[model samples]
Target: MRPAHVIAAAGAVIASLSLLSACGKDDAAGGKSGAIAVTATDSSCEVGAKSGAAGATTFKVTNKGSQVNELEILAPDGKIVSERENIGPGTGAEITVSLSAGTYKVLCSAGMTGRGPSQTFTVTGKGKATDPRLDAAVASYRIYIGEQVDDTLAKTKKFAASVKKGDMAGAKAEFAPSRFGWEAIEPVAESFGDIDPKVDTREADLEKNQKWTGWHQIEKALWKTGSLKGEGPYADDLVNEIGILKQRVGTASITATSMANGAKELLDEVATGKITGEEDTFSHTDLSDFKANVDGAQKAFELLKPVVQERDAALTSDLTDEFAKVQKLLTKYEKGDGYVSYDTVGKSQRKELSDEVNALAEPLSKLAGVVAK
Candidate 1:
């Protein structure tokens, strides 16, 4: 979170993450052992070894930089394999990732600047096959994804019935909590390709001539225009597409790395959408979505915490403390079971919230790397 002019929500986020991880041979991706040590300073990234086998390589990173720095593993396609963000000077962190046989870049930046030096590491051997334990964990996560879809579908159906009955007040009341189920599983929801945008597209994200037909579209009609007439079809289409997602996610495979990165990404979602007040602009229910996104991300981290603690107890403790701080800060905005409207949050308050979220996110960014098989 950087200081901006603090304008009103742009009312849109650029949402095309069309391209979007591993621990073991039996771990998350495939398994091998050997740490690729890295030293970072203001000027350079030094990787200890230039080449190794393709699975379970740990990057033991020491930030000798003049200030805090970040280290990232970029895949050949440029997607982040994993990363460690905001590491303070004289501090060190380890990121273990399962790698396939290929060339990859180990990049680092001092003071969080864009410009940085990088070292190339080559994986010379094949990845090991998946371990049964990793297989079961992935299976369990898929089951959890399925459960959320079921819950979301149930909530959205009730929401749909309210819309179809032309009960604007009832539909408005259901808006925040109903969206919770969807937000809680957004990491997985986002994977169904077109379904996520279709289900939640804000009017700002609509194509030049494309019609809007999701929650935000209906939100505009309900809260801005104060009408739900002719909105039933949007409701129907939303739930039907969710059903499609449910069926698809049931057979989908999830990995430990995905869950960890998804957790980090979810918090990023809050930092971008909620802290900035760019979501639910008309209904001002951004706070509810904000909470739901944190819930989803935290759930994923909680699942991987056991493994993280096994690797680094100190980092786990830091994460625990930061998460509690963020949760406590968010609780202040609650008025019983609901939150105050987003419009009521002033710029300074938003800055405070943004700072707490960034605090949480900095420690959280290390999670995916630590848990890599």
Candidate 2:
């Protein structure tokens, strides 16, 4: 979800990520405990360690830069292995990822745009074994994401067929429903860097001379022109890209901690884009997207609840209540199946939604640490 217009909300929307752990805990830091230290500035990304044993490793990411920044570990093929975004100046966050023996790139994106700085890191030997319950959680999540992908692909194909047939009203009607699955499992789709930019890039996020193709490109044509003229090619491209996404899902590498972090990232998606009315700009179907994102986050939490409950039942209980609160608030605006147009939502109501998201995000941010423990 790259949109130039939405950066203004970064400070407020993403500040919760800074509290990934409790106060005064360096156990997650790079210093004596084998965790990697990553110090980021506008001009540099300094990683304290060059190599480590392969297993679950934590990266203590600190943003020393003047602007808000993000840290990411990418595979050799350029897919994001793990990431922590919207780290404000002088704040810190931790990301715990399961690493296999291989070479990886630790990259930092200053101001959350363009690649800022990166370095090579290596892992040797299969480090440590994983818990059986953690393994089960990962397995269950994969099945869930596969189901979402199947649903998305089916709906997108139907929407594409409508456009190809020049059925303008039919295409418009099918548009928002087509995107529900993609929005739900977005973290997986976004892991494959090349596929997301092609499949979901908004027009404002289009780079110079880059030919835009994806949901938003077609979204613009459908809502603005009220016609599907010259849109057949883009619709075909959407189907093809989603097909790539389906294949990639089978090979996705995910740790238990990553699933928790991804749930937090989905809430960030809501605060930054959906709640701010930046996601479904023309269609005004932001609430539908909001519900999908929350549902996805809830699914991830539910799968991991076994481990979390064993460790910290209180946190688990708090998360369940917070998620239900947000979902219940959304229910008020429900139309027939989807939500009412976003423009119809007034300022006071929007504030209520934002407040509920913030409440959920605080407890949600601690999920990664609890699950990793």
| Poorest 10 consecutive residues by lDDT, candidate 2 | 16-25
- On residues 1-373, what C-alpha lDDT tens digit does candidate 1 reach at each position? 1111111131122111110111223222222435666888878999888888866777777777666566777666555566655455665665666778788889887754333799888887777775554556566677777788888888888888998998988888888877897888776676453676678766655545767787888888888888788888899998899889878776443567767767876775686578777778898989999888888877777766767787889889988888888788889899767798989999898878777776777778677667664
Quote the positional error of residue 17 for candidate 2 in Å.
6.9
Model 2 misplaced stretches (Cα beyond 4 Å): 1-5, 16-35
TM-score of each: 0.70, 0.92
Residue 4, candidate 2: Cα error in Å is 6.2
Candidate 1: what lDDT? Answer: 0.71
Candidate 1, residue 137: how far the Cα is off, in Å = 4.5
lDDT of each: 0.71, 0.83
Clashes of 1: 9
